[model samples]
Target: MALPVACLFASVPVYAGEEDIYFSDLPMVASVSRLPQRLADAPTAVTVLDRAAIRASGARDLNDVFRLVPGFQTYPNNTDAARVTYHGLSDEDFSPRVQVLVDGRSLHSPLFRNGMNWALVPVALEDIERIEVVRGTNSASYGTNAFLGVINIITVDPSVVRGFSVSANHGNQGVRDYTLRQGGKLGEAGNFRFTYQQRDDDGLKDQFDWKDKFTSRLFDLRADFSLSERDVLEFSAGHVEAVTMRGRLAKSQNVLIGGNNPGWPIHDFSQSSTYLQAGLRHTLSVNSDIYVRYAYVSDWASDRYLNQSANPAYNYDEAGDQGVRHEFEIQHNFVPLDKMRLAWGGSWRNDAVRSDTVFRGMSWVSRDVFRLFGNLEIKPINWFTGNLGLSTEQDSLAGAHTSPRVSANFHITPENTLRIGYSRAYRTGSTVDYRANWWEGSSLNFRGNRDLQAEQMDTWELGYLGDWRGWRMSLDTRLFREKIPNRMIQVQNQVEYMVEVQKIQINGLEYQWKWQPFDTTRIQVSQSFIRIDSEFLDSALAGPLSGLSAVPRTNLDQLGERSAPRYSNSILLMQSLPFGFEFSIAGYWLDKMKWTRNSWQDRYSRGDVRLAYPFRWGPRGGELSYTVQSFEGNHGEFKSYGQPADRVVGRRHWLGLRLDF
Candidate 1:
């Protein structure tokens, strides 16, 4: 079936054109500019994810969402353990290096290793307007969390919608879900929208009787009032709340050693968050306009490890993050000269983070941090564009640092554009690396690196883009080499029952491609190759450092060999059939990679399908749909040193109904 579909796509005749369609016409997942000027002129690799494609693919979470994106990868640690990786290097969590935004507000958590709690992101497949993905470095434009890439999610506007809609679904693995949405206009300038959704299911795997569940509610209100013929005020605010319960796996050996207790120690996690944003825009002249934006985000999470016998004691972990940012932008469309137009802008932001932990009537740890930053952009010609930006920030604990960026774009022809860009990106070291006082179980203390310097990277890229009628394509390849004078790593020795830690720097490259061969089908592919040279390591910790932790112990040579096969790719197909019917299929594949001082090899491939048909009853409409995910029942697995590999267990299926009036 897939072969015939591929043949059909290959047989289609290529369309041709001279006028380049604006980037605004591309479906986006995030709030990018509604015009093509920024996308065409910006000196970065950006890809847009359309809503039609998203609906067709039937992705239920961030993992599935990123499968269609190139150069991005994800690994499931267990039933409850999932993490994203980019540019070949990844932390326990990838949030700090890859910034994610919903409607222009950053979703990164300043308290939790700079990673966003994916379980709390208030995004529903049905509400997505578009997603804008920028690959390579972007710390200069979006601040701290943009080390490797940026994912921006945009939701539908209230003004363009009318009436109410509802949907219900059920599927494999005991899956059940539902969604409710309402949107319409009020009076002359007010528009409002509200959406509610819930999901619950016994996952595909049988390990620990895994159960996945979540609930989300969102509200958006917008008001447009004209103060004068030349000025107008636009006010908007959005609020979202989400909650979920996640399950984790316990090593069988650990369970057996402790006794034949199945309920030994169960790991369960939960998260909740609320986000609010508002913006105003005014036209100063026919050629110029100015706008301001503000946002407030609050998030909380709790993790529990419960002992199942006698009087079960629960070790509780809790944390919260609050952020506020303000931005001012100005645009002028008038040409400075014939064939040349100029646009420029500036932005400022401030972030605050706090966290705490507790176990058996004791305060484990606590910390707080604050950061301030600013940036700018400029365009000199219609066919040629340039940008120069810099930011200086200070952390209460990590001190201060400065970053700079520069980029240029030149139109080779109306049908082809060339781009060259460079940026310096950095990430503040985590508290665990700075202030952990004790090991997981031992009384031995680990001191914090107060003098630790931020990890920084120098990234450069060359890209080309072309568009012709229904055929659109883009290719961007980047080379990144980073230097971390105080890089951090945690090492543990099982043979000698000892532990050692240190830091080192590295370098790498990323390649990406986006091709849409038909109006109903699109294909994206991304690959990354990285090399790390650890110039420092304690030679005395031989066996554990060189044998057990040989992967990291190798320093430069070890880093090089360990960094191969760090790549990911995916393909998606969606078709709108005649008579209100639709069908979609998507496939994703990722290479095995490792994390921590432990040598772990991991990899997996999966596919999903969705079908829907609409029916009408008088003036109302309704639809029935069916979805099957992980149709191949692929299981994720990880191998650790001296220990048997652990498999990530789960699969899912769903059926649903929707109504509109």
Candidate 2:
């Protein structure tokens, strides 16, 4: 395995300032090795979304966060219904292709088709330490659900924070938000931190008006007790409470049609998550170390309809879901021979999910996964290095899969490097696809497919990186082909008022870029193109079925194309100003993409800007900022079956303030 990138950048103390050490530095992890290497020394593409850049972009949520990073696309009808996709295999109502994690905890709901509940994640932008985005397939290193990419959100360590802060913002569409955070040390051996945030917005469209809110309280306690100079033990726990209202579906059939319909009844939902991790590290020798870690996760959520029609015959409903996961990981590093390094690790995870619908009953599922992987690093020349790795995972639903990866870095000159890499990745089938119960003529019937298979991808990347004086720029592009066999979709047998479950396969390509012209300026851009085709397998099917079908296709399916986007890209720019101030601007463009098999295309372009100033008052510190989001005021449209396919929604703007002591 390649040594942590920290070892290489440790000697390069290009910035010598107190704030540089705390606010602008990347975490010391091995994942960033390819970033700092010269453009001529490596052949793989990489993008780094630094903390300062993220803060300057004025992104309000994770959807806005991706606006600054190229190659990733976030689709949010409103604050509550948001989903991200990579390489163009996405649906309006499903989990994304990429995997999202915050401080090593997955943000996906195992019972809801493995999709994310965007509204429940209460991470304040101010508390983010940094975000590491790995584009291209990385299942070999991170495991399943990493078929497209990995987004790792690293938070601020309590020990490094010594004060408190608070912030509030109000904007268009009745948007309002407030956040508070505090951190300090207890004696010399213990450290703790806590944060809470709430957000509510009326949204851009009439029917789309909704509320997105979450309150997350986290506690991290760390104590160092040394039995000897070479041993240490650490423990930590994090908890979060996120609540949101699901927006009204564009499809009328799914909406309440009778009296007292407040346009759309709020779908009250909540997600509570808790995580515990414990680790022990030991140094066997001056150049070797071994560690063991055990982690546990508990997640629960409930979605319920509020304020039903007054008619006694009408029925209101609620659905509750709960899941628990336990993981064990072990890793070791050693120099068994001269000038050669080796690192290896293995992990095991088990997840159990249970769900119940008020009108239906209850269902349960259990899944277990185990993985083992190792990497070796060797230097063939003083400036040439190579890394090779292999991993295998056994999933309860998808059987077993093995992936092999290889990468090389070559230092051609002092200022440039070249990187090349290739890997295979796969995504396990979602539980939502295997087990679900949609309403059937006012009655409920369970729908499931036990034969669902894992989606797989083969990825290859090439890239260059460079650094000189105060200017640094890097570009990474990838060519990939993914085979999503047994891909799930909902098929309706209208003749019998019954729905049949089915699957299909798809294939595509993704490309992205990152650049920095000066220490205070940065820009990023990316695009994805895909081609999807499907075939039906149910014996009840008749003639020929051609193109891909959007999940839960409504009347919209009759108007457009299926499951593919022609192209999508985002551009972002940020620059620091005088007086602890910063300025930022971002623009997003989505090409005309088909909503259903024959629905008309909807295209849109949006932009946002912000101005921020950081200062201190008495013994406290604070930040006053004003943001104008959706400055372009573009009117967008959402298409759905059985609903007017061309309804328009307007844009919005907002401003906010923050304080810390």
Give me the candidate number with maximum lDDT.
2
Instruction: Show how many residue pairs clash in every candidate, following the order shown.
Output: 17, 39
Error of 2 at 8 (Å): 7.3
lDDT of 2 by residue, 177-242 (tens): 777667776665556666666666655564432334333343333333444666656666666665
lDDT of each: 0.55, 0.58
In terms of lDDT, model 1 sits at 0.55
Model 2 is weakest, by summed lDDT over 10 consecutive residues, at 494-503
lDDT of model 1 at residue 214?
47
> What stretches of model 1 exceed 4 Å from their correct place?
1-38, 76-81, 208-264, 305-383, 431-447, 470-486, 490-565, 578-580, 596-601, 614-619, 637-651
